[model samples]
Target: MGDTSDFDRFYTDLKETEKKDSVLTSKQQIDRLLRPGSTYLNLNPFEVLQIPPDSDVDFAKKKYKKLSLLIHPDKNADDRERADRAFDVVKKAIKMIEDPDELARCRETYTEARARLAIIMSEKRRKQKKDGLGDKIPEDEPAAYNKALWVVVTKVFADREKKRKMLEERANEEKRRAAEELVAAAEKRRKEEEFAKNYEESRDERRGTWRQFMAKKARKEGEGKSLRGTAFRPPKLKLETSGK
Candidate 1:
């Protein structure tokens, strides 16, 4: 806050730490690649390549070659597994840089960061002026501006990743539900077909049972008529006359 150069000094110290990565051994590079926060950090291809986002694809390709060699599994046979993973990370970053759409998105993220940083600096200047403090903004320095830009860029990438994951999950859920509905519809149709088949297969048996019932009823009626005709009347009329 006292001197604008202090901000520059702070930014310089951070860059110096990053510069040390260039000379790191293969083991160290693997460790850094697979570090605790690497998942979040690796969201930015620029961060993975250790290059500025504004760099052209050619420059990014060159950087990728150097980083790839540093962490290549063939170069570090003792730690091949980790080195292979690190190598994959580098490969993905280079692929993103080569892709026109992804490269454009990366550039847009940097632009957004710059725009957000500008708004923040503008607000800070406003507050300082209102408080009668001289309008000297530390982030006006190139180093300080870069340092602030880094923060905003990281945030933008993270937000984008979060939203992407959410949308993906939603789409997967919809697909699952649609698949289940298709299975249910197929099952319903199968049951209906099975019922129709059974009904058709039993038609002949039902007709045979009906014919047997009708024949039995006719035979009983014929036997009743035959009994009535053959039944004896006896001499009942003559006995009744003698009693009278």
Candidate 2:
């Protein structure tokens, strides 16, 4: 039983080693075949797409479609796993390069990456100079050392774009809310004005009725006084009694 267990462990280890070796072989092939350089092939999207740096929209779209089809996983099923990763890279590159907004973001990312690389290289150079190895250090290696810089730069730009869009949406929402508030305020003012106009008209009408009522009462009192003044009085009742 122990012997069988040992054999099983050895088989598993051997299989793991073989798998590791295969993965390593694939990695080496990818590095050798796909790596871009300044002299041979610039990794810049325009260069890879075989278009001018200032290519128009139509050209960019064409290049993106062509590259997508070329590196599509279905077409490269023999290495579908690697092909899928490559396709993703190509897609990201297209996104970073095609749209004007995305292109601007990419340029900003490139600038930041260059600045960071400069800082790192400057420190390295400073250290080398301090150690009396300045003569051995090469200045042409900064660009070469920035192999993974694009990945970092792209992420930063993507994050910035997301935040910018969120801010724009928030601003739009605030503007919409402000507009609604203005409309509501105007409606309230309209209602208030209407109420004030109706109240003023009603007050005027009541004032007219009160003035008419007062005039009518004054006229009735005058007539009653006149009638009392003009009334016939029983005059000489005293004289008649004296005759009797």
Candidate 3:
């Protein structure tokens, strides 16, 4: 609705005509969401809502409500678990469209996908033009063109998904590495503290032992000097004069 009307129109046609040919029903989408290896596939909110990424917020809200009601656990009791999962995805999609930054990201992906398809379509048309045919959806081969367009869409989605997974994996790896580093740092600090504590205790014990040894040495030296001075005294002559 801002300055991307053409892009929005192309996306609308892709979903309504070509995309619908692949069945964009609530049940069908829910099945896909629950399928194995769908974690990355479900990252695209536009695909989750089965609508154009550039859709108005009001339209997206309406779609969310419709899909939520269709897949709400209270309504689908028999398949409640899968239905709940699907409902959660729809709710997440609603939130994504409501968030400005996330909405921009989805829009960016959609724009890139559109540009890729446009390039492929133009090239095919150019080849046709060179072959003496007009540069448009060939009238004689509507089915083939539609198939070609479908193939392009599938490939775009696949490529987008692959890139999304790579980025996600890289982010997770960084987080894991950070956590490991944090733990390692904590352990290193603890060991250093323990070593410092042990060193302080050992140092105090050595100081105490050195002080005792010096005290004993001083006492033995004083005893030896007293013995030397007493043994050198002239006592025998004084005893003889007292007897006489």
Q: Could you say which candidate leads in TM-score?
A: 1
**Cα deviation of 155 in candidate 2 (Å)?**
3.8
lDDT of 3 by residue, 1-244 (tens): 2455754554455445434534455466567567553565467777677676569889999877877776788877878888899888878888989999888877776667667767777787789889987776552376655444544544566777788789999999999999999999999999999999999889979999999999999999999999888756666654345554
lDDT (Cα, tens digit) per residue for candidate 2, span 1-244: 1585664564354335434432434343333225433222324454345454456767788867866676677877788887776666666667657668866654565677667766766787789889988634454565345333543443455556668789999999999999999999999999999999999889978999999999999999999999989869787655344554
Best by lDDT: 1
Off by over 4 Å in 1: 1-14, 130-135, 210-244
In terms of lDDT, which candidate is stronger, 1 or 2? 1
Candidate 3: which pairs clash? none
Worst 10 residues of 1 by lDDT: 235-244
Q: Which parts of model 3 are misplaced by more than 4 Å?
A: 1-42, 125-158, 208-244
Candidate 3 local distance difference test against the native: 0.72
- Order of candidates by lDDT, top first? 1, 3, 2
**Candidate 2 C-alpha error for residue 15, in Å:** 25
TM-score of each: 0.77, 0.44, 0.59
lDDT of 1 at 80: 91
Tens digit of per-residue lDDT, candidate 1, span 42-71: 889998888887899999999888889888
The full ranking of all candidates by TM-score, starting with the best, is 1, 3, 2
lDDT for 80 (candidate 3): 82
